[model samples]
Target chain A: MQWEIVIGLETHVQLSTRSKIFSGASIAFGAEPNTQACEIDVALPGVLPVLNARAVEKAVRFGLAVDATVNRRSVFARKNYFYPDLPKGYQISQYEIPIVERGSLEIVLGERSKTVRLTRAHLEEDAGKSLHEDFHGMSGIDLNRAGTPLLEIVSEPDLRSAAEAVAYGKTLHALVRWLDICDGNMQEGSFRMDANVSVRPAGTTDFGTRCEIKNLNSFRFLERAIEYEARRQIDVLEEGGTIRQETRLYDPQRDETRTMRSKEDAHDYRYFPDPDLLPLEIGADSLHSIAQSMPELPGAMRNRFVATFGLTPYDASLLTTSREFAHYYESACAGLSGTTPKLVANWMTGALAARLNESGCDITQSKVAPEQLRALIGRVADGTLSGAMAREVFEALWAGEGEVDAIIERRGLRQISDSSELDRLTDQVLAQNAAQVADYRAGKAKAFNALVGQVMKVSKGKANPQQVSEILRRKLALPGYFLPGA
Target chain B: MALAIDDVRRVAQLARLRIEDAQAAPMLAELNTILHLIGEMQAVDTSGVEPMSHPRDVAQRLRADEITEPDRRAALLALAPRAEAGLYLVPKVIE
Candidate 1:
């Protein structure tokens, strides 16, 4: 029997504001256990919440970027529950009306793109942490992360496979970083993904029951968890068994999903409007102001790269993964004369990217500046330096030795392209390798490359490779050349 | 709906409150009285009335985005029932 997987993601993105959502405590991570917890965050008596305006601004900016309906007035509600980590005994969140609704993100699958519709994006507060390790059998509660702001984005069940779901997750991550709303860091728990996975028989319309897999923080985990859960559901149905609706946790060590709780044991969160905060309102003037200040979105930038710079679809997508990287690429090629984008992109993605990954530094933190790289690119384009020699000079530039020209001169790595000088070297190379010279005249194409290698090696790699190939073709084909050791 | 004896007992468990059997009947009676009053109010709803979250129509008061609070971990830890190593100690919680 054939089965189809259905997936919808609920992503919790922590906004990058300085303060908590409803308190003035610093939202810095890795402080002392409860140092960042203020009175309101810890739920002290007589303490009331004061909504952070900056968090609301972030949501509005995201809404504008996605072309969503930014609700002018939205209410905050208390999701009542009891847990040790929940200091307030209830989480202040949005229930009936969310801040942003009906947004869509574009995901590229293979060579085609599709739009994933969002149900809503709501503003909520993060709970504290419960530390069970090193407790001597007693758990400890750290309220430092309490009251941190989160924008919960729920998507429509439009995805059909694990690959599609992860692609959607990646696109969303890039969009959040592009909008400057979230840092999109999974290790720090800033951006987390939860997937609702179910399987139904192919060519059927009725929906099957779904069990949610919780807190998949990385893209690999997201894909693996969805694939495991969908297969689990299909196996149960194929064996004439029923799948229980529940919440499951993915064990990275085991690479399997385990049942955390049954649906019958789900908490009944008696939700009601939070009376402390009034309904949030965004004025039309403010919406217009934010819309005017919006940066070029990733989708727009990717299309422009393809159209303007003639980049491949894959290269354009990769270059626009982050705003900082995209800006670096633009600056490296910006206002440079006589250079093609193909050359600039090849260097950025190949050489510079490899170096950055090796040093564990971001492109923004690179020692080689944009204009410095542009100068390196310029020399390579005009044949002032061989590709091999250019790489040596680039290392010098990255190490802060000197400018491109100075580094090239200091290392004596300039390409030798004088035709008279290359003619003398070519004569010595063809005489030494009579086999390759005879083979070249006998129409063996690869023999010509062996002759060029000899000329470059004899010149100590100072000879221009193009000039060696060109001069070798002229000397080996003099009309009366004799073949030896053929 | 009115609260029965069992309903009140379950609510007590969820709230982590321990009520003796002797107090269960009176607790049920008092909670039912409050519910009966709430039921009476629910009977009369003017269809056009907007649900009010607060008694007065006022905007929420917002605070500036500046750090005005200092780290008072030692002072606050002094008020905990049991604390060690800058953490609030509680019973070991398992999900």
Candidate 2:
């Protein structure tokens, strides 16, 4: 029987503000545990939570980027629950009316794109960390992370497959980084995802029961957890069992999802408006300022790469994965003479990307300057260097060697593109390998490539393969040439 | 809605309060009296009235994003019943 997977993601993006959402405490990660927790963070008596303006600004910036409705007035609510990590016994969040609503993110699946509709993006305070190990038989509570502002971006159940869900997640990660709102660091728990996964029989509109998978921090885990949970649900149904609507935890080590233990009333978070904080109101002036401060979002920049550089959507999408990467490509494309943007893209995504990965260097830390890359691409385009020779020059450039022209001149790696030089070389190769030439004249197509390889060997690997093939094709078909079989 | 003795016991348990069996009936009656007052208030026609989250009409004041708090870990840890290695120790809690 065929089954379809349905997934929706709730991503918590920790805003990059310096201070916590409610208090004046530092929200920097990796601090000594509980050192950053202030009196307000610990929920001392007579302390009130004052909303952070920069957090609101960043949230509105995101809302504007996604063309969502920025609610002018939104209220903070107290999500009441009991946990040692939650010093207040409640989490301050936005309910009923969030700060941003009805946003959509366009996720590219292979060649086609799908718009994942966002239910809402709410502002909330993150809970503290609970370290379960290494404290005898007791738990350790570090309230340092408490009250850090988070924008909980919730999406509708639009993803159909694990791959699609991963694509959506990666797209969202790139976007938050592009906006400079979140650092998009999964290891530090700056951005975390909770996936709602379920499966139904193919061609059914009735939604199946979904189990919420909590805290899948990595995209790989998100995909794997969803796939495993879907299979588990399908198995249960096939065995005449029903899936329970509850929260589950994904164990990455075991690669399985297990139901989280909760008291019967634990899920009932009796949310009410937080009486301490009044309604948060964003004025028109503030919204305008935030809109003006908005950066060129990833989607817009991707489209511009396509429209301006004539790149394929796929290439554009890959290039615009990060703002810095797109900037690097543009800087290289600037004042390009003989080469096209497509060629620059090939070199960037092909050679440069591989080298960067191998060396564990970011695009910003690239040793080869953008202008140097443009020059190298120009040599390839003008036939001054074959692809192989250009790669050699690229390596030299990457190694802090001199400019493209000087490297080519010093190494004598220029392609033998001159017609006469290639002709003489091809003639020398053809005469030396008359048996292969005879094979070629006898309609053996494989012999042609062997002949070109011989010419390249004669040219010391500098012969342009395209020119060698052309010269060899013309010479092999000559009427006056002797054909051994004929 | 009126509260039953079982409902009182459940609420007390949720709040982590200890109440004897003899106290349950009086607690239910008192909770029901408060609920009756709230129910009477709910019966009033306030259809056009906006749900007031706070009594005052003032919006929340925004705070500038700056770290004004200093490291008081030592002083704060002194207040906890059991703290070691800069972390507050509690009863073992598992997910």
Candidate 3:
């Protein structure tokens, strides 16, 4: 019997607030251990926790982006546990009700888009890091990350395959960055994921026991861990064994998972409302302002591109993946209305992307401003320059040589579109190449192309190929050729 | 409504604390006193009163999102009993 994989993700997005969640300490990564950790972050006595309004605004911004209902009021609770990294002996987090509730995101893989339901996104404080290396039989604590604000986004068990999980991850990564809430930097542990994976027999509605795979720091690990855990569960179930619910760690070196601990069912985290913080209540004015301040979401922008700009859904999605690129494209397309948007989209995704990669810079850092690119696109859109020549002008602009019109004029690369001038060039080529013209009359398409090339060469490659081909064909069929209609 | 002595010992174990046998009864009694007072308050008919998470009328005193602390690693780590390489060392903990 086939097995179905059920996967859910709990992603911790470290909000990019300038300070710690409840303290005025820096959360900058790569700081020395305990250097940025203030007294409150270190859990000193008599130090009380306070909320950061910027962190709250970021959470609200994310909620609006996902179309989730932003709970006007939410409560902070203490999650009690005994870990060396947790100096306070309990983590301040939301329990009974989260700030954001019941949102869904559309994850598109190629042409198929799937919607994943989110259970909730709660606000919480991060714990410090435990350093085991070079400690000689002891572990060290780096409280730099302690008390950092994190928005723990939990998704429903809706993903079916490893590929879908990865796509969803990438989409979520882009969305957070687009919202400017989280930097979505995986290398710095700013964004982390824990996947719960299980496998049940196909066509069954009953759920199977899931093992939580913790701390997948990278997207590749997220995909591999979920895949490996699913297969492992299926193997055990097939061998007449029951799957045990436990927490496992993904060892990337071996590409396998081992039991971290055989969890004794549930650790009753005695949760109670944190008496230090009052209930967080948002007003309608706050919600309205946040909603009004939100930039156009990717989905809305994608539809607008398709409807207004006449772009394919594929091109629209690609351009709107990042806010910077989307803004760049819009700025380039500004004031150039009724022009072919696909021209801009094609160059942005195709030639411009290749150039940006070659220069090893992002769109923001690239010297090629949107206006410069727009000028180049305009040359190609009209009959001023050929596509290949337009590329050369782009390179010149990238090298800070000159503007588009000046480069075209200085290099003498303008297309010869005057029919009368192209007619003279075409007639001169036909008269000089009588044998090839006879071959063209003999129904040789190659000879016809040769005549067009000859015209272009005779005009010193200034004549437009389309115009030359048209005038050449019209001239050949007039009366001096072998046959007009035969 | 009284807390048992065993309950106190269980909580102590969960908290990674080793309470002496003589201390367990007093801790249990102390916890029971608080519970008894709560039980007495539960008898009062204050159905319309809204539960407050904090006694203060304010939600939370929010601080500006700016880093105001400087590095005090050497001084703070000196407070710990063990230290190495700018890290506060503790007993080896794998889990």
Candidate 4:
């Protein structure tokens, strides 16, 4: 029997704000344990929480970017829980009224596009960190991150496989960074995801037992965690064991998930509207202003690349996947007359990407200037240099050398387009391989490829391969003195 | 809306509490009382009402892509029960 894997993701993006959500304390990571914590963050007596205006603005921007409904009024509730990391004893979050509702994200899965519906995105304060090490059998709490603002984006269970989940996560990652709302840095815990995975029989109406996998910080880990959990659940059900609804932690080292606890319902948190803060209210003018300020998102950018630049859907998708990469590509293509975008994309994807990967640098930090890259592409288009020679010039430019013209002149790497020179090289190749020439005359057509290889080698790979192939075919069709079968 | 004895025990275990089995009966009654009050929120119709995620309506206030140092090293260390060489020391589990 076929099994269907159903997955949803809850992504927590820490807003890149200068201060805490409800307090003026600096929202800086890696601060000493409790130094950044103020009385409000620690939930002291008689301390009332003040909402941060910048944090709310960030949430509004995300809502506008996704074309979701931004509520004019919302309320913060105290999620009552007991933990060492939570200094406030209860976390202030939205339980009933969320900020953004019914947003959709478009993700490309293989050759087809699918839309993943967002259930809601709400703003909440992050809990503090717990240090289990260093203390003698006692855990310590660091409140530096206690009041940091987080935007929890929840998606509906529209994803059907692990690959789709990864695609959704990556698209969300790109969207957040492009909007400049969050840093989307997985390594620094700026962006993280918790995957809720369940499986049932294909086409079944009933849902299977769901498991929440926590703390997946990278796309690779998100895919692996979901895949492993799906298999584990399927095996358990097949073996006549009941699937328990639980929260599990993904162990990246083991590449597996372990049960953390059984899932909790909303009633378990004992939620109530927080009296320390006032109800949030916004006017229409503010929402309109935010919507106007929204930049070109990844979807719009991809379509523009395809339409204006004449790039294929796949090439456009790759170029616009990251904001930095897209900016670099457009800057490189600027002011280059008669250079097709397809050509520029080829060079960027082929030589530039390889160099960036080798140097462990991003597109912004690359040594090759956008203008110099354009010049190299111009050389290829004008036939002054072959594609093979352009690669060599690109390598030199990536190594912080001189410009394209200087590199070509210094290395004598100009293409051999002169027919006289090419003809001499071709004849020399045919004479040297007399046996192959005889075989060709005897109708062994495959033997003619040896002559083309010889001609390219003689020219030191500077010869235009297309021209060489054309001249070889012309010569091979002529009546030869060594025509044996004829 | 009150919690049952088994519900209290289950929630306690989910929270990683080492509660005694004998205390389950009393904790269940207390949890039930809390739930009964919270159940009042369900009476209000939330249809077509948008949920609130944050307090403000502003969007897209990004920090400059520059590094800012967080200068609370001393205060953070003060919360550690044990610290040496700017590192928190934990019990050794492996040799």
Which candidate leads the pack in lDDT? 2
Q: List the candidate 1 regions with Cα displacement exceeding 4 Å.
A: A134-136, A202-206, A337-339, A441-443, A471-479, B1-55
Query: How does the DockQ of candidate 2 come out?
Result: 0.85
Query: What would the DockQ be for model 3?
Result: 0.61
**lDDT of every model, 2 decimals:** 0.88, 0.90, 0.87, 0.82
Per-residue lDDT value at A226 in model 4: 95
- Interface CA RMSD of each prediction in angstroms: 1.4, 0.8, 1.4, 8.1
In model 1, what is the error at residue A100, expressed in angstroms?
Answer: 0.9
- Candidate 3 chain B has its poorest 10 consecutive residues by lDDT at B53-62
TM-score of chain A of each: 0.93, 0.97, 0.87, 0.96
lDDT of 3 by residue, A446-468 (tens): 99988888887887777888888
Off by over 4 Å in 3: A1-3, A235-241, A265-267, A416-486, B1-13, B19-58
Candidate 1 lDDT by residue in tens digits, A1-486: 999898999999999999999988999988989999888888988998988888988899988877789998888999988888898899999999899999888887767888999999999999999988867789899999999999999999999999999999998999998898998889999999999998999999777999999999999999999988998899999999998999999999999999999987787787888878888878889788888989999989989988888888778888888899999989987875343676888888888899999999998898889888889988888888888888888889889997998998878887888888888888877778888877877899999888889999999998999878877777676766545633
Show the colliding residue pairs in model 2: none
For residues B4-38, what per-residue lDDT tens digits would candidate 2 score against the true structure?
78888887875668999998888888999999999
Candidate 2 chain A: 10-residue stretch with minimal lDDT:
A261-270
The i-RMS of candidate 1 is 1.4
Cα-based TM-score, every candidate: 0.89, 0.96, 0.85, 0.86
| Native contacts recovered, each model | 0.64, 0.88, 0.80, 0.05
Full ranking by TM-score: 2, 1, 4, 3
